[model samples]
Target: MTDESPAFPPPPPPMGAPAAPPAATPALPWYRRRWWKFPAWAWLTAAVVLIAAGAAGGAKKDEDNASADTTVESVADAATTDAPPTATDAPTTEAATTTTVAPTTTRATTTTRATTTTTTSPPTTAAPQPIVFSGRGDDVVNLPDTDLMVATISHSGRSNFVIWALGFDLQETDLLVNVIGGYSGRVPVNMNADTMSLQVEADGDWTI
Candidate 1:
């Protein structure tokens, strides 16, 4: 064996100086790379869900506002269109007043009538007079005659004088005497000297 190993010739220097290589191999086509694609599907689904939730919230707020507006409108209409009271439906104070007035008037009229009735009156009576006889001194002055006579006269000269009574044989009797030319009948005397005088005077007929 040769005592010293023969030195191998130095390795030949690397070809061209050591160079930076390309970054990576070419990616697979879209249809063929399957392992990491599930993450991409998950991101797309999350985005779609977020959009649907926002739309639903907006629709719910609009419905609530519309309902509140409808309630307010109904209240306003009720306030403006109420009905008024009618004549028959109101209280009856006037009827009471009318009834009271009628009764008062009737009472007053009745009182007046009663007062008038309380104030009236009545009548009276008369008297009586005495019977008498009268005559004038005239033509037939008789003496002891069987006939006895009595007379009456009217002062007004409107009617004839008449003898109202007579006596015969001293028994009194009624007799009629008729005379003319403003002369009453006669004056008489008896044998016993019972002389009688007669005359006519004014203020109605009287005996003396």
Candidate 2:
């Protein structure tokens, strides 16, 4: 009784002995377990956001380039339609020319002639000689030296056939002249007379 002293306390561990280990904590979920896991996830999320934004920006830039090309093509077409035409596109024409010439002429001429005149004269004639007459009776008369004679006689008688005779003596020959009683006209004779004489007779009274 008295000896049952209070349960004695356990004795102290000896020197150089290992201490007892602490009790282990319970295992958490995979997300909560590592301290660096949260920062790695945040970095991955930032990388994904950057890639999506870059793709969207690339698509928008391509759309803007297509619109610019279309606008340039429309401007070029309008400029071509408004320009003026060149010299080769216009029409061509030709002109005509003419020349004229005059003609020459010649004329003919004529010649003239002159007129002439003539004059004439008359012929010359010899003069005549006078004659001597004898009465009706027988008579003898001397004559001049001449070669030609003209004589006339007249008688008063009723007989139609009475003869009258006369004779002349030349130098070498004798010529006899005869007349009828009724003769009254003149007679002409030609003879050669060196010397000349005349004799007259009639049957009746005669005049010469």
The clash count of every prediction, one per candidate, is: 0, 0
- lDDT string, candidate 2, 51-147, tens digits: 9999999999999999999999999999999888775855756667777776766667777776666666677676665766645556655666577
The per-residue C-alpha lDDT of model 2 at residue 84 equals 81
lDDT for model 2, please: 0.59
Give per-model TM-scores: 0.22, 0.33
Per-residue CA lDDT of candidate 1, range 32-144, in tens? Answer: 55645657786788789999999999999999999999999988888667756555766657554444444444444443444455655565455323235443432222223
Looking at candidate 1, the ten consecutive residues that score lowest on lDDT are 138-147
True-vs-predicted CA distance for residue 94, candidate 1, Å: 24
Off by over 4 Å in 1: 1-38, 83-208
Regions more than 4 Å wrong, model 2 = 1-115, 126-129, 157-176, 203-205
Highest lDDT against the true fold, candidate: 2
